[model samples]
Target: MASVEKVGNIEPMPKIYPIGGGKGGVGKSFVAASLGALLARHGRTVALIDLDLGASNLHTFLGMPAPKDGLNRFLNKHAQTLDSTAAPTPVTNLFLISSSTCSMEIANLFYAQKIKLINAIKKLPFDYVLIDLGAGTNFNTLDFFLTSNKGVFVCTPEPTSIENTFRFIKAVYLRKIKQLIKRHDFDAQAKAAVLDTASNALTSRDIMDIVATYDPEKERFFKACIGRFQFKLILNQFRKNADAGLGKKIETVCNRHFYSPFEFLGGVAFDERVIDSIYAKKLYVKNYPATASTMELEQIAELLANGQPASSLLQPAL
Candidate 1:
């Protein structure tokens, strides 16, 4: 667990990545744990926050009993800071702040409480912080996901999961546009791109067209906000020949439909050992080093930790 420290001595803000699924039982937690374990194994200080909130169960992936102290303490005033509640996990250099112990009402966080937690999350001292979010495209989930330096969407190859994940991505994009519009002093053209309800989001003119609609000087300004988002995708439980190629397919769909800077990071293959590791209450990457899943997870973590430029990650000609 990371001990509380004063802000003056801390380094740069750590890379924050929030992982969420369109629905449950798609192995979002499994993929999250594997990434955390891999990052920790590589000697990065990692914090895995189980923001599945009141129903938190990420501790199970780390092979631990339910956390007795965490977000609840900070929220209920038992602790002064959220970072102080990070509980040490079995993995070296990795800590978890599970909130399964929180009361049911904690799931419905007030705006003030959510802001407080978000501010605290940014201040936590670590190389990487991966938030495991609850299922849904609700305000809480999208807010947390957007707070990440890079938003990660995890979904199975199933059509339902893929469609819902698309919905979640679109929801987050709308939220992102709203935030950028509020924060930046956008001119009329830029404002219309975001505020216009009739704009075809997936077809016709996308964000680039909106930026070009502005005056030449203002075009750069609008592009800086509309064209600069980094979101990563992971396809899990991949089982067939087509499944292996779904990464590029998703990238194409995102480009054509949402004008999104979504990068298909990689895919995780279906493996029996994953279930075995889960049943044994251990992270598959840490416990089954020789497995194909572990190898794929290691590669994905490496790519994520390397942190490519948003434009480079996205498909060309977008």
Candidate 2:
């Protein structure tokens, strides 16, 4: 295990990447671990943070023994920094920051605690800090997800997962707009004035238009905000080619509704090896690299790292 100092001069303020899925049982942590391992294998120092808080299982997925310390300790100032809780995993260049052993209560975190945790994550020394966000659209999860430079949303082909994923995406955008509005002290009076001028309800597009019209100077800032809000969608547990199309469908819906172009990350097929690897408490990539599921995950890592379009790799070859 290499010490954090051994990472050599920290590669230019690594990009913050957050992995989140609206609903549970969507394989968010599994994909996060695989992506981190792949990045580390390519010589990038990666910090995999299990932000799942209450139900954190990233340590088990990475094959690391349960930690004696974690985020909870740091949040309480019992630990000095996030690095203190960082544990070395079996994968080279990959480290795990386990979640606190505390109960899985989302409301357990106060506003100050939330800000402190986010600040600590921003200070971690790594080339890529991948946060495995807990399931749901609660303020805590949404705030952390938005704080990252890139946000990846994972979903299965099932309708329930897709519906919840849409809700999550919409909630994030709406929250962002509200934050921006509050920053300018756009109180009830100002909001009423803006609403009277617009025909539609308070949507992201309407917010942008209002900002551009009245707050012209901040238009560029809002545009940059929308541009920086990158999203990548993945369809997991796919059983057939038809199932893969679900990703594109979701992407279209997101683009139409949110006015955001969501990248379609590749899908993972239903593989029994994944289940077996989990049962054995091992990473699927290291345990069964040759399996179809593992290969698909590798492709996802490659696409994300290179910023390649999902359709180019996911489409059937003519």
lDDT to native, each model: 0.77, 0.76
User: How many collisions per candidate?
Assistant: 1, 1
Model 2 lDDT per residue over 111-172, tens place = 77777777677778888899999888888888789766478998888889888887788778
TM-score of each: 0.82, 0.83
- Consecutive 10-residue window with the lowest summed lDDT within model 1: 1-10
- Clashes by residue pair, model 1: 202-257
| lDDT over C-alpha atoms for residue 70 of model 2 | 74
Off by more than 4 A, model 2: 1-12, 103-107, 185-188, 191-224, 309-318
* Deviation in Å, model 2, residue 159 alpha carbon: 0.9
Best by TM-score: 2
Clashes of 1: 1
RMSD, each candidate, Å? 7.0, 6.4
lDDT of 1 by residue, 181-278 (tens): 55556777667665677854532235445655663465555445545567788988888664567888988888666654878888888898788877
- What overall lDDT, based on C-alpha atoms, would model 2 receive against the true structure? 0.76
